[model samples]
Target: MAQKDPVLALDNQICFALYALNRAVTARYRPLLAELELTYPQYLVMLVLWEQGAGAESARVSDVGARLRLDSGTLTPLLKRLEERGLLLRQRQADDERVVRLLPTEAGWQLQEKARQVPARLMCGLGVEPQRLMALQQELRSLLAVLEGSAPSD
Candidate 1:
């Protein structure tokens, strides 16, 4: 009988480590964002949407889902909740009815100004230099890409 490799055990998985770390990191953002009535996931969606601009904050549901590492099943209800809160609008694209676009409302963009302080607050709490943090981010991103099988090939 072949013995299992210790390194291949679930306890040694990089994904599990990241999962724990991700939860811990997100915990830091919770109370800080309560003032804006935003949850970590909602704030992350808003961050991505803000980059897309006011009128067309979300190019496609798939795009946002991919960026956030979320599935449509999850995004669908989240988008609906956001729409209900009047922070964003979701509708099918004219060219492709199957594709939905997410557009932030005037109220949504205003939320970005309040969120601007989150990064600074997080940095202070971590007590790390910006360069160190950037390096860590790059490493973590690479780890995520590898786990998702999205890393670019040479």
Candidate 2:
């Protein structure tokens, strides 16, 4: 009988590892995010908007989409839901009706304060060291950069 091929093993697949890790991390965030009335994607969107700071003109729909690596189709529904919840306003630029700008509302800014505990809470629940997680995050970012063709290959 032929021996099993190591390359075909599920345990040896990087894609499966990443996929599993993504699901695990997102699941861990579920309850914490629920407290903020946000799903994982919504929490990511809010993080981007909050990082942009409080302003009349915070970010364009394109800017958010680019930062999140999401297409308009997927991002639009999330933005719409957030807008409907009074967390943000989507307004067309006066100069160009096609250009949509996102402005976080006061309620959205207030939510930021409550969300401040989410990261620490999630890390505590995972029982992982913060420094180790930071290192893993950097490595993932490097891998993503290469996959996106934004980084030089060895």
Candidate 3:
């Protein structure tokens, strides 16, 4: 039997580090989000909505999906659950029957206040300097853009 290459080991893989870190971060968020009755994905969706400026809050379902890099198959069910929880509303556009728009409910808007401190709390828990986190986030986004841009050619 051939020995496995050291370069192929799990501990040496960047993907493994990313996967483990993602899980750890999500685990850290679990308890924090539970207090607001939100799952991590739900909180992400809410973040997008909350960031939309005044009078421009509603977004097409496709738009939301695009922003989150999600597809209807995955996003639809999450939207439905949020709607059921009275956190958001999904409606078909009057002019475009095929277009579905997502609008946060008053409750959802109210919940934003409750969630305002989440980032700070998460940062404190992470024990990373804000500047370092921002730089790392920028690097990750750059990596993501490169990966996404290369996909069709692959």
TM for every model, in the order presented, reads: 0.81, 0.92, 0.94
Tens-place lDDT digits, model 2, residues 1-154: 4778898889999899999999999999999999999999999999999999775457998998999999899999999999999999999999999999899889999999999999899999999899999999999999888789855564
Model 3: per-residue lDDT, tens digit, 1-154?
4789898899999999999999998999988999899999999898888788448847888887888998999899999999999998899999989999889999999999999988889999998899998999999999999988896677
Per-residue lDDT of 33-67 in model 1, one digit per residue for the tens?
89888888888888889888764446688888888
- The lDDT-based order of candidates, best leading, equals 2, 3, 1
Of 1 and 2, the candidate ahead on lDDT is: 2
- Candidate 3 versus the native: TM-score? 0.94
The number of the candidate with the highest lDDT is 2
Where is the poorest 10-residue window by lDDT in model 1?
A: 52-61
Return the top candidate by TM-score.
3
| 68: Cα error in model 1, Å | 1.3
* Candidate 2 Cα misplacement greater than 4 A, ranges: 1-4, 150-154
